[model samples]
Target: MTDNPTTERKGHCLCGAVKITAKQAPSHVGTCHCNMCRRWGSGPFMELDCGTDVAIEGEENVTIYPSSDWAERAFCKICGTHLLYRLKGSGEHMVCAGIFGDIDGLEFTSQVFIDEKPAYYSFAEDTKNMTGAELFAMVQAQQESD
Candidate 1:
């Protein structure tokens, strides 16, 4: 139930066209409520930050969209399943949370683009919620510090 660096997790696209393996358990699991994410998945996009320790088995079947100046959204080209959201600056990969079947011990820690989250739905878990602007500023500050 902890974020263990040595743990490995495996998953595949809906059509099994692309397989993914992460060398470490995610440090964070988060939900994104931005318009782009909502439109992409018909709801808030839940994801696991797999960092740089992820490997793709069928990269040729993956397509990437430059969703923003700082990030790109990737998906399985064949089945149209969302694959990963990647940071352009750091190359960090946030894989779709549902892709990994029967995973345990992952924690839901935060939500981003909170200002855009629809009022019709809410999560009961108390999580750190960050507005789009706040998230961007925090990311920028982190990059600058790095």
Candidate 2:
């Protein structure tokens, strides 16, 4: 956490119900091409390597909508702040990178579910494309290592 309170990054969902504060900016950011992400974010939702230390308050007011059997989308019930989308059966939370207050130098490096991405919209930005199978395989491998 930053000692100089002024440097702390702060943000909340569209609704003031779900507020977040981070001491430091995110280390990485990228977009997801998975259909669930598209439907949840209206566009490729940005993900951040936030680790677990990120403090999330007012969780009670957040609405968790299970987008699929394997995932859940979280939004603020009062203000409908699209806060987070968590993968099912995992301890990880994919936070929206765009919400990081005044963050800069973010680069999109990979696009998961590229094969399923809509054809009408093309990604002009450079990023490594990964199929759903490829991503799931990697996730499975990580789970096994844990």
Candidate 3:
């Protein structure tokens, strides 16, 4: 992650019901092309690993869905804007990159579940792509280490 201890980035949901603040700029930005992510956002879900340094303002307006045993997804109840995808085991929150008002230095570095990506749509940027199994293994290893 970049040393961004001084930057405090702010953002809000579509209806302005849920506001969020990140204490530092994201170190890495990535896309998930898994079926669940594609269905949830109608495309690859782009996100930034904000670690645990995020603050939410409209907690009451946020609804969370347990998308998997290992993860849960959160969205703004009013506008249905996807807010975050959190790892249940580690409590790592990957906030939707699209919601951030300032994305000046974030770099799209990876794409997960790449095997499930549709043929019709593709990104021009060369990224580190991992299949679903590879992604799961990486997460599992991380959880074990923690």
* Model 2 agreement with the true structure over 62-102: per-residue lDDT tens digits: 88888878777778888776777676676356677766666
lDDT of 3 at 63: 100
What C-alpha lDDT, on a 0 to 100 scale, does residue 17 get in candidate 3?
96
lDDT of candidate 3 over 1-146, digit per residue (tens)? 34433366788899999998877646578899999999999999998888778899999999999999989999999999999999886677888998888878777789999999999899988888999999889978986898
Error of model 2, residue 4, in angstroms: 24
The TM-scores, one per candidate, come to: 0.91, 0.79, 0.90
Q: Per-residue alpha-carbon lDDT of model 1 for 1-146, expressed as tens digits?
A: 34434367898999999999977756467999999999999999999888888999999999999988989999999999998999887888888988887477777889999999999999988888999999989988987898
What is the C-alpha local distance difference test score of each model?
A: 0.88, 0.70, 0.87
Q: What TM-score would you give candidate 2 relative to the actual structure?
A: 0.79
Report the error of model 1 at residue 138, Å: 1.1
Clashing residue pairs in all predictions, respectively, total 0, 1, 0
User: Which pairs of residues collide in model 3?
Assistant: none
Q: Give the TM-score of candidate 3.
A: 0.90
